[model samples]
Each structure stands twice: as C-alpha cells, then as structure tokens.
Target chain A: MTTLSNTQELPNGPVAAALLAGGAGAAMLGLATTLAEASAGVKNLLVWFNPVGPLSGKTGVAVITFFASWIVMHLIFRGKNVNFARATAVALTLLFIGLMGTFPPFFELFVKE
Target chain B: MSISPREGWTVLHGMLFGAAFLLAFAGGFAGLYSLRPEWVTAEGIKERILRLKVGLWAMALIAWATVISGTYIVYPWYRASDATSARSILLADPATAAWHTFGMEWKEHVGWLAPIAATVVAFAVTYYGPALAKKVGERRALMIFFVAAFATASIAGMFGAFINKVAPIR
Candidate 1:
C-alpha cells in the first residue's frame, strides 16, 4: 500500500493547468452566451439540439473546451512548476466574465434587436 | 400521489443532484479550510484527504448531473413553444415574464460554470493530496474555485425553485 506523506513535493503546474482551463472553460461559456444573444446566426448555430435550442451548443462547447483545455494544459504543465498566483488571477477574471455574461441584465445588453 | 416523468426528472435534477451538491459544499469547504499541519496530525490529514477526495468528486459529479439534466431534459419542457409551456406561460404575463427571460436564462447559462469549477477543485485536491495543506497559495486558489462552484450552483438552484413555483414544468 502506498503511504501518503505530508512532506512530499509536488509540482504546481498541473494545478495551474486545471485553474487556467477552468477559467478558459468559464470564459468560453460567457462568450458563447453573449454571442448567442448578439447574433441570430450565432444563436441558430448554437442550436445543436433543437429541443434545447442554443443552450445545447453553448453548454456542449463549454464542456468540450473544459476537458480539451484541461488535457492540453495538463500535458504541458505536468511535472513542472509555474506561477500559481498569475494563473489564479486569470482564472478569477474569467470566472467574473462568466457570471456577468450569464446575468440577464448584462447579456441582454448585447441583444441584436 | 405520484408525479409525471418530467416532474420526477426535475426533482432528481434539483432536489437530489443540486441539493446534494449544495449540502456537500459545506463539508468539502470545512475540510479544505482546516487542512493544516497545526490543525491536524499526519494521520488526521490522511483521513481528511480521503474524505475530501470523495466528497469533492461527488460534488463535481452532482454538479455536472444537475446541469446536464437541467439543460437537456427539464429545460426542453420548460422552454417548449406552446402557450401552456413554462416559458410561454411566464412570457404571456408581463408581470411574470422576468421569470423566464431573466431567471431561467441566467440559471441555465451560469449553471454550467459550477461543474467546470468543481471539477477543477476536485482535480487539484486529488492531484496534490496531503501536500495541499502546505501549499498555501494553491490551497487558496482551490478554495476560490470551490466557492465559485458553490455560488454558481446556488444561483441556479434558487432560480430553479422559484421558476418552478411561478411556472411549473408540469
């Protein structure tokens, strides 16, 4: 059995990757939401499932972006050290964008009509 | 008395999955916050880490399940084009129109972020394991993600409850 040690050294890169990927995923959702509101073409394009309408494409793309970016970043950042602070800052900013973009008061501002 | 299939699914998505996610956050947050050398012995840390791993992952999965069910199953029914549909019913009255336009729209979109953030927190905690206690910066970042996940889910859940009350999926 592998005994876990409290003192073991671990690289912060993977955590950074996860953080950045999370932010990117969130940002993508925000961008998609706003774009969908702003353009009929974007809304129509995002109707991946007719029943769910644009939400299908919006969420599907966000999930895909999350996993895809996580994989890519994990590969790049694994076994390496990175600036955790910077990555977290970027992530928070992206998260804020996501929150604002989803808010009706905010996203409605971008409506094409 | 029994519920329709749509109501059953709505219950599962909101009450079972969403509520579970919310309830689990307190445990996960407490565990994460107290994971320190001074706060626990090595043995205690090990036990806590295991609990955190299980709890965090469960929360993440529940978050995903909630959003998936909401966006796919329940949402279609809510947004159906007929006048009797929830969205149409809400939109039919200027007084209740915001329930669909604002509440439903925000809930659906912001809800996706919860899973993404929760997954990140879970991955970070599992990847680092016991060593996370020593990584103050990393731990802080994970907590932020965890809290963000909770906040997003809470918004979605609250709106979901209200929307259902004002304009039920049934």
Candidate 2:
C-alpha cells in the first residue's frame, strides 16, 4: 500500500474500483470523440443545408488544429492524463463553436441552396 | 427547409446533453460514495440530489416561460390561421426576409420540441437515477425520484402540446 513501483500508487478495494471506472469513462469519452472525428462526413452534412460554403471557413482552421492535437496526444501519446484531457478539450471547444456558426446563415435561408 | 414546429432534433440534443451530464454525475456520485464514502464530509448527497432537482425545475421554468413566451409573440408565422405577421414577413427585403422566414421556422420547431425534450430528459433521469441509486444502496429514494421524473415529464409533454395549440407561439 505504501510503496509504489510506478508514479500512481496501488489503491485498496473500492478506491481502486472507483479510479478504474473513472479512467474507463474518460477513455470511452475520448474514444467517442475520436469516432465522431473520424467520420469526416458530419462537417459536410452541416454545411449541406447551410448557405455557408464550408464547415470550418476561417473558424474551421481552428478546428483542424484542435483535431490534429487531439489525435496526436490520444492515439499516439496514448492517454497520458493531462494530454488526453487537454486534447479532447481543444477538439470539443473548436467543434462546438464551429457548429454554432451554422445557424446564422441557415436560419436566414427559408429553404436550401 | 420547412422547419417543423417540432424541431425534435435540437430539443432532443439539448435534453440528451443534460441527461448525459446527469448520468455521469450520478455515476460518479454513486461510485465514489460506494467506494470512498469518506470523501463526502459535509451534508453530502442531499445537496447533490437537490442540485439535480433544481436543474430540472430551472429548465422547465425557462422552457415554458421564455421559449413558449417568445413563441407566442411570434405565433402568426407558424399558424397559417395567424396570417398577419406572416404577410408582414413576406413584405420584407430579400436577406432580411429570408432570416425572418427561416428563423421563424426554426423557432416553430424548437418551440414544440423543448417540452417534449424536457419530458424525455426527465424520464432518463428517473431511470438512470434509480439505477445509480440502487447501485449505491439508496433504492427507495431512487425509485421515488424516478417515478416523479417520469410523471412530471409526461405532464409537461401533454401541457406543451396543449399550450402550443391554445396560445400558438409563432
């Protein structure tokens, strides 16, 4: 209990279980984010009905950078605690703001292009 | 793009967003309490339970009051019966006109959807809530919350439809 071979110490029964579950949740969330990213079609789908030409436009450049960072850290660096959180946060922030932009033009257009 | 008054998509998405957070929170609470009961030092789960309850209440109040209120002020567009606003909108210039038309359509869809979304979210809370509570040994309270959630949501859904028809948010 006292001595740890690694940086994270070995935990007791319920503590260990809790930690494991939290870790699993974080990982699954990361995986889900990754899957959403992998499908590239979603971006196109948004702009499809949109009067806007592209999903990212100027803001989209930001999204790509976030996605790139997220992928490098999670898939490549393999889920270091801070890295995973940071990467996912970047991707999410960009993605959410990016999606919100669609409303202005789409809401204006009575029908589609 | 005739935005149906029931924009099930956006409302459903928002509800799901709230639901997902609720579940994750519940799961964290139950799992944490079950394993590490010591971490909860203060007047613990009571506050947490109250937080969840308050969340739903706040959502319901805003949803009915603001969303539907806004809808009624602009109800002429959604209801063909109320052609006054509709004709005015038709008279606007091209771009502004487009926004009025589509924005109004989006408003209609989002209007019908909000309460239904709330109801679904409530049902989710009830189901997942009890399940989480049962996992942590608070089976009785969990059941009560779950049942209340479902019942409240069902009523909300029914009322939402009725309100939209009677008042008709444009």
Candidate 3:
C-alpha cells in the first residue's frame, strides 16, 4: 500500500451524466419492448429495418436515447458537481425497470389478445 | 471440415466476439475491484490504470461488435419466416416453443444492455483515470455498472448457446 500526497479532484458531473444516460437508454428499450407487446401499432412502428423486424427500432430508439441524454446532461453538468448518490439511485431504478421490461414473462403481461 | 457462410457468421458472433467479452470480464472485474489507493502504490496504479483502460475499452468495443453482428446479421437468419428458420422451428413444436417465447425474447433484449452499460463504465473509468482510486463511492458505483454489464451479457450468451443447440440458425 502506498499513500499519495497529491490527488487531483474532478467534478462528478460527467460520471453522473453517464450513469443517468445509461439508465435512460435502458429504460427506453424496456418501454419499447413492453409497448410493442401492448399494441400492434407500436410493434409495426418499431420495425425500422425489415430483416431485423421491430428489434431494429427498439434498439435504435435506445441507442439514440442513451447518446442524446448523455450529450444533453453532459452539457448541463460539465465541470460541475452534483448529488452523485441521488443520481445513482435514480439510475438504478431506471435500470430495474429496463430489466423488467425486457423479461418475457413481464412484458408478455402487456400483450393484447 | 468446411462450414457454411451462415455458420461462419454465427461462430464469429458467438464464439469470437461474445466469448471474448465473457472471457475478459474476470480480468476487468478484478482490476476494478482492486483499484484502491491503499491497495497499490502510485507507481503501481499507473501501470494498472493503463491495463484497466485498455481492457475495459476492449470489452466495451467487443460488446458493441457482438450485439451489432448478432442483431443485424445472425438474427435475420434466426428469425426468418421460412419453415427451416430457427424461430419457425422452435415455434413449430410446442416442446421448443418456450425457447423462442422465453429464452430468445429475454436474450435479445437483455443482451443489448451489456454493451450500453459497458460503454458507460468504460467512459467513466477513462474519464476519471487514476483519481478513481481515491473516490470510493464513485468506484463502487462503477463496479455496479461493470457487474451489471457482465450479468446481462451472461444471460444473453447462455440463452444464445442453448437456443442454438435446440435450433441452430442454419
């Protein structure tokens, strides 16, 4: 073990941005998955690519949400500190929603007969 | 023995890219776990940080590659509407229908989370660099993200393997 006398401190904003954005992206995917099951319109709308079917749109929306949210949050919080703990909690909640949304047993509940 | 084009792509996506990400997880996890100011000297951190960055970035990239290839290439074949398609074969029989309904459904969506989470972890680590060692809370959060990435990938890879065994995409 070694002790360091000097360690530079950087703002936590960027990390917070990443965490939040990741969660947002994941939540979006889950939302898309569940919605696709709930409505035929959503399922068809998500079919961005023919071969890949609705998966293309589902993932496309997620990728877009992740990057877009990241950029927006980064710009707002750049070089600044925020409540890291709060950010983490929110992100985790979003992630949980994402996980549940993707699970077939869970999403299938929304399926229309 | 020679393999068909579809088989070759399947091998490349699952065996090459997916396996590489899974295999690298141990090293990355260990590095992240041990990345503490008390655990290593300043000089030691410099060395470990470089290796960690490289490994994390590689894992992230490989994850992206795996999903993209799986989604755009192999998935089309597996999900084709033809009677011989993997999805059709699985759905054609009640015994195997659950593989598509449950296994494949969870795998495809959850698999995507791995790359997204991984990229976030990679970016955070690179952004923080050696300073990450001192920030205990931040480091812990990153570890959670890393573990999440690994867990999601494992689910996808496992189901992918099982699904292929049950009904290959050929």
On TM-score, the stronger of 1 and 2 is 1
Weakest ten-residue segment in model 1 chain A by summed lDDT: A1-10
DockQ of candidate 1? 0.64
lDDT of 1 by residue, B1-170 (tens): 98999999999999999999999998999999999977888778888999999999988888999999888899999989899999999999999998888889889999899999999999999998898888899989899999999999999999999999998988
lDDT per residue, candidate 1, A26-74, as tens digits? Answer: 9889999999999999999999999999999988888898899999999
Candidate 1: CAPRI quality band = medium
What TM value does the first chain of each candidate achieve?
0.93, 0.27, 0.95
Fnat of each prediction, in sequence: 0.82, 0.00, 0.74
Q: RMSD of candidate 3 to the true fold?
A: 1.2
C-alpha positional error of residue B78 in candidate 1 after TM-score superposition, expressed in Å: 0.4
Residues B32-138 of candidate 3 have per-residue lDDT tens digits of: 89998788888788789899999999999999999999999999999998899999999999999999999999999999999999999999999988888888888
User: How many angstroms is residue B78 displaced in model 2 relative to the true structure, after the best TM-score fit?
Assistant: 8.6
Compare the candidates by lDDT and give the number of the best one: 3
DockQ (C-alpha based) per candidate is 0.64, 0.02, 0.69
lDDT of 2 by residue, B1-170 (tens): 55544444323422443233333334423532442224432334334444555555455444444333333332323333334444353434564454334443333332332332333233233333322222333222223333322333333344334434433334
Candidate 1 overall Cα lDDT vs. reference?
0.91
Model 2, chain A: how large is the TM-score? 0.27
> What interface RMSD does every candidate have?
3.0, 14.8, 2.0
